[model samples]
Target: IDPGHGAQDAGAIGNGLLEKNINLEVALKLQSRLHQAGALTVMSRTSDTFDSLQTRVSKGAQASADIFISIHANANDNSGANGTETYYDTTYAAAHSVKLAQQVQPRMVSALGTKDRGVKTAGFYVIKYSRMPSILLETGFVTNPIDASILKSTAAKDRLASGIATGVSNYFDVK
Candidate 1:
């Protein structure tokens, strides 16, 4: 499942690209790729809209999904910062969340050739509220030039989807 955004909370923006749109696009692509890989998938949002954090968490819980991956793009004051990073809730003891991130980070970095912004822990709303193993992936710094270019490309987006699908398959041991 994917969390749209913080709701009424427009995430970061760069080069006239809104973070919300990037998140939705990546989430949709990830859903499609995962389905093609024979994994059942669901998304918290499929359009340009806002969803409350509680609603997203509730949806995941209701689905009783094995894993939840929240797709998002990063932004920073330092436009030079660029990389793909994943996050798991620090309070959660689920190793799968971290392991999933570990499995995907390399693929993202390799496919996009972006900086390797190592996995980190955060008390993100989505991760914190999710009952199942959950991860929030920051695909890249939308504020950065190089990263922005990649985000705008269909090829790069598809590559990101493939990497995410590969990671999920690895996590579930789905051949």
Candidate 2:
């Protein structure tokens, strides 16, 4: 499910790219691709509006989704740190989450040709609250010029979606 940041909270912003927008775009595309692959999908948000993190988690849980992935972009004050990273909840020992990250990270890096940031555990709200194997993927660094260009391109976005879909398919052991 996609978590759209709005109202008071603005996620990461750089090079006129907002994390919220990127999240929605990638989530929509991923949903479409997953549907094409015969996976049932649901989105927490379909527009540029705001919803609480709890609400997003509730929706996913209520749906009984097999996996929940929250899409996002990264930023840093340094403006030099750039890469793709997927995160899972530190408190959860879900093998599938790690497996999904392992499957997705290489594909994302291959498509973007960005730094391999590796996977890590974090107590992110979405990951923490999700019941199923969940991941929060930071697709790229918006503050970095090279990464920003890739993030802004439609081709790169499609590649990102396809890579993520491939990762999901791998995780589910679906051909």
Please tell me which predicted candidate would have the highest lDDT against the true structure.
2
RMSD of candidates 1 onward, in order: 1.8, 1.6
Model 2, residue 156: C-alpha shift (Å): 0.2
TM-score of 1: 0.93
Q: Which ten residues in a row have the lowest lDDT in candidate 2?
A: 1-10
Deviation (Å) of 137 in candidate 1: 0.4
TM-score of each: 0.93, 0.94
Model 2 stretches with alpha carbons more than 4 Å out: none
Per-residue lDDT of candidate 2, residues 1-175 (tens digit):
6755754566899988888888888889899999999999989888877888999898889998888898889999989999999898855546877887888888888877889999999988989878788998999998998899899998998998998899889888942
| Candidate 1 lowest-lDDT run of ten | 1-10
**How much is 117 displaced in model 1, in angstroms?**
0.5
C-alpha RMSD in Å of predicted model 1 compared with the true structure: 1.8
